[model samples]
Target: MTQTTPTTPVPPGALDGTGESSKGEATDNRARSRAAGPGRLLAIVLTGQLMAVLDVFIVNVAAPTLRADLHASGSGLQLVVAGYTISYAVLLITGARLGALIGHRQAFLAGLTVFTAASLACGLAPGTGALIAFRFIQGAGAAVMLPQVLSLIQRTFTGASRAQALGAYSAVLASGAAAGQVLGGVLVQADLFGTGWRPVFLVNVPIGLVLLILGPRWLGGAEERPESRAGGGAAGRSGALDLAGLLLLAAAVLLFTVPMVLGQEWGWPLWGWVMLGLSAVLAAVFAVYEARLAGRGGAPLISPRVAGAPGMPLAIARIVLAMAANAGFLFVMTLHVQGALGYGALRAGWTFAPTAVAFGLVGLNWRRIPARWQPVTVPSGFLLAAVSFAGVGLALRDGSDGGPWLFAALVGVGTGLSFAYSPVLTRTLATIRPQDAADASGVLVTSAQLGMLTGVAVFGAIFLGHGPGVDASADALWATCLALAGAALCGAIVGLVIRVGHLR
Candidate 1:
């Protein structure tokens, strides 16, 4: 062989396929050292998560108080709940894309700051109109903060640490709603030095402040991947946010949500149906627009490819139906027990304690589960929940006995917890590349939020449409519980399909 000019040798592994990834991991380790330790980072993120979840559930408890204190109309109260959820859901994709452009840590701080300030405004709001407006803004803040949680966890940790962190996150997700119900009752009952329901919002003030001040120091810059930067990837510097797509998506969601929120109060007016029809058209338009954009190699608010992946559509559908029914179950049960059974707020709160406990016990230990077995957990869990819910319906039908009802609720919650901690998220987004994880997280969360909105609107409409009475309330509870069982059945089917498909 002819002698070649001497050249510097590349270090071993330097030019290997994994070299870049190894370098990235090293960089992340260095950055983590400069920032907060894993424990502190976990605390900061989990606290943010708890606040968001608490706000969603706590408001249900505060509905009656809102109506009484602010002289809110039925539709207005619905708006107070729906407004926050709608805004939160609508803006999530934009929020995730934003975190990529700026930095997740920065976005998280900005969101927390805004959320804290808005909570203060909500506490001080003098009228129903003002409260609704503030709640929307608060929700917008939540949209920004929530996506950062998953993104940061992925970026900051690895291996066993990642597993542990995710387990805690899931536990909080499982328990947050039930915990909120109980906490909301205690605060409302205490009245917090005559603040009435205001303290529910006010309590976030101190907690949020501490997070805001230290968050920047504790959380460092996001670990951005080079390929991810070009699209909806981690810390991607996408040319620009697809504002047109965002607007279209927002319009579609608003169309669907507004009718659901206002239809009952307006006596199921013709216009509401028209809006629902329009929502379908707009949703179709959004889908088409996203496809065309993706075809052109452009960034869409939600990546069309990811949304259309194998299991994603099914996952979204399952989440919407199951979560909607779950939300409706909480609402109708609260109304029936407090309204018809004459149970105090505290008593009503205690009704869900077993669910909360079960969720905590199972969810915190979710990581101990082996990967191979995790796939079957979701369907099994849902089946158990379905049986428990049917039992609740049977109890309600048989004179609403306290012992049977509470026992069913306990078993339902525990069963719900057992399987709800499954890796549905990872399975659903299995086709999604690591670069697009944040975008997938955003889409997943948005679907869940919309599901909650659907639950409140459709179920609330049913409850209000029947007018007020012990009998009407009982009917509403029975209807809602049956619906929950049905929803769980649907979930079980979807889960089984996914699992069977995997076996192939």
Candidate 2:
């Protein structure tokens, strides 16, 4: 038997099953400290991410059932859906930073524990209010847990291994959204044990419990203090929480996301616009304050170095664009099929499966494209997505079902989006220093969450605002598709202008 100890360094790729470096031989020292190895580590982290992202869309299909059983108010029903989104968005930046202070593994487990418990509460709640409250806690837990997935990948993988890791990460991120709808619909429709919509929330309980058990072992000893390095100042390496910045971030994110979440539901109330404006002001103030705090040698909530990293601004802009377009496409398609075509939840949910499958396939395999053509992949993806969305709009012009062509179009859209985003995310993190990866992950996740909300609000409004008629709905969906295509085109132009991977 081989000797192993806390101080013993593991060989690169030793625990990855093949006993060979993936693509490139480069390895991170931090990763070499792994007790359970990178393969298990990646599995653990992605499992957490799957659980978090799955809940994001799972409740959409179950809402009506839940409302009827609980006799929920309109706003309460919205909260059941949007409550998770709001808390998840508002707390992301803080969650990202939490891993830096506590050990990443500890933070991850703590958050997972919270999420699992909240999910149980949500499943068993006696009233809509309790479910809503539990959903917020669940979202808060997700917000805390999700960022660590990105950060752990950044810190633990290098070279070709890192690329593949990010690919799988991208697959999970995109596929989980559609998967949520499908799973939710199946669970609700099946009504196993005659539990109505409870199973949708309860399904996570067992999964979460399993993950919590495996996390502490495979995630290394994040609860234990990180070992000190050669010199001094190991403590400084683990940053502290800046409560002021945390509060400001929470306030800004809440103010913005709440309005975007509820505005259309409330018929675009005036107070929503007021909140939007206030959000902008608060965000600006937060920026100025954080910058000042960083200048003073204090631990800023968002480190200036991470935010101002080379090519970061443009990279973030592309993320926002990609996510917003993706969200808008999904939102519009769901509404178009269900609201107009009058499909049941399960049927409507199945409509999204093709997109999810195509995205996963492309996400996992996109790297197989020849090196010579790799540079054009992102722009090309954007272009494909743009054309696909345009085609969808044209097909829907007459207010009739687009037939099998609709599924093919969805496949194209998903493939295009996978190309547009997964590589960009990989390239963006690759450019940042590993030490700053946590902070960078925070910025990225926050941007993506906000973009999703923005997409649904802006694009949903365009589809919804047109009023209730077959012709009107068809025209509105067409317009919405055009807008989505336009957004993709803009991203394509940006990708062409700035090669994210090549940014120095």
Candidate 3:
């Protein structure tokens, strides 16, 4: 059998291949620069991601303090949280487009500047309204920067290094979720500088400043190669920003997101249902409109050919389902442990330590696992997660204390590696052309954000509606567990189907 070479040209020094010496020498120099500075580059980008993700869960621990300190009413408090999420979710795709239009490095720097400045504003806000507004700005800033993380990784790294970079992204996400809560609890308890919950927002200021100063120099010109800047490889080459598509898509996302964020808080009001229904209709319209634009040889927000790829739909579904389960379960568990079980914020946060540890370890070594095992690994991991979730529910019901939760957390760690993200992401993007990387990454992240929001809303509703009882918390935990189990089952089926059909 003859060996087949990759059609996508490997960047110079990307592989030890037969080639001209002068070109190889130039590529080698570029590769050396990348190797020497990649750590710093990765640091700046990953830190941005960590901060963005941290903001998502960090505020939960500070909510009561914010309410009291800012004189925030119940609705005001909801807005404080929801504002960040809504803006982040709605503008993520737009942000990705902006990165493609200008450059990832420029976009990232701009975003970081906005985020850091907004963070400072958040820390200093004297009222709930101001805080909410600042948080929204912060979210928009995060949206503008987060997509660049993946884009830069795609551009700057290749082969195993790229795989490792992706693994680190997954690890940071897992740790940030748990660490945000833990750090928030600790900071609130410390009340350092007599600032109460202000430290949480203020903390990003210094880090952001450091990154802002060093990011430009370290990231350098790697992100602005002529091909990337020209058309972003493939997707960006099409046409001007699809303003109409952007508007419709943004409206649809906002409509869908607002209800998910606020419906549980407002007891699922009629207007919320209306918004949800309208969102679906708008989504359909957006799809039709995008398809028309693509057919007309115009730039569409989502390329039909890309979205129609064999495993793309299932992969997206897996993302939404998995994120929904993870987000919803975490939300309910936080309430159950703190409210019903009388656990303090710090204690509640520590319960997830096992998950972070497991996730970190697996992420660090994910490349050791062969690519072919992905299909089997993912479904197996989901099944394992289902078992752990069931154990958590059972533990809650039996009043078996913390031991069971720890075991469950540990067992659930595999899911973070194989189920929560890495495998599915690798598979989904495996066949995508490099030019479309930004669009594809944006789609993936947006689906994840929506899944998380929906999980919080749908599962929050279930937990909130539980009537007073001796085991009300347990009942809620069980319900959340069942939902997670169902999600895991769906994910497993998708994986198995893909394997059986040889779709990958």
How do the residues 1-504 of candidate 1 rate in per-residue lDDT, one tens digit apiece? Answer: 111111323233321112232344545554674576777888998899889888888877777877898888888898887777767777887777777767677788888888899999999999989999999999999989988787676566554455566667766765777788888888888887788889889989999999988777677545444235434452353556778888888888788877766676678789889988998999999889888887886777776656765567666766676567666667667777788777777777877777777776776665456755555666666777777776776676544545856676665756573455434543343344435656777887778777877776777666655557776666666666667777777777765565555568
Ranking by lDDT: 2, 3, 1
Minimum summed lDDT over a 10-residue window in model 1 is located at: 1-10
TM per prediction = 0.86, 0.90, 0.89
Give the alpha carbon lDDT tens digit for every residue of 1-504 in model 2: 110111223344332212232323234334453555889999988988998998999998888789999999999999999999999999898887777666567888889999999999999999988999999999999999998888778667766777789899989987788888888878888989999999998998999999988877888755332211211111234334677878887898899999999998998889999999999999999999988876776767776656755556666777788789888777787777778888777887888898889888988988788766666777788889998898888777798888877867888988998988887777666655555656887899888888889989999988887888778888998999999999988887774355434444
Q: What's the true lDDT of residue 296 in model 2?
A: 78
Winner on lDDT (1 vs 3)? 3
Query: Which 10 successive residues of model 3 have the least lDDT summed?
Result: 15-24
**Candidate 2 segments exceeding 4 Å error:** 1-34, 223-239, 495-504
Best by TM-score: 2
Q: Deviation in angstroms for 168 in model 2? A: 0.7
Give lDDT for model 1. 0.70
lDDT of each: 0.70, 0.79, 0.74
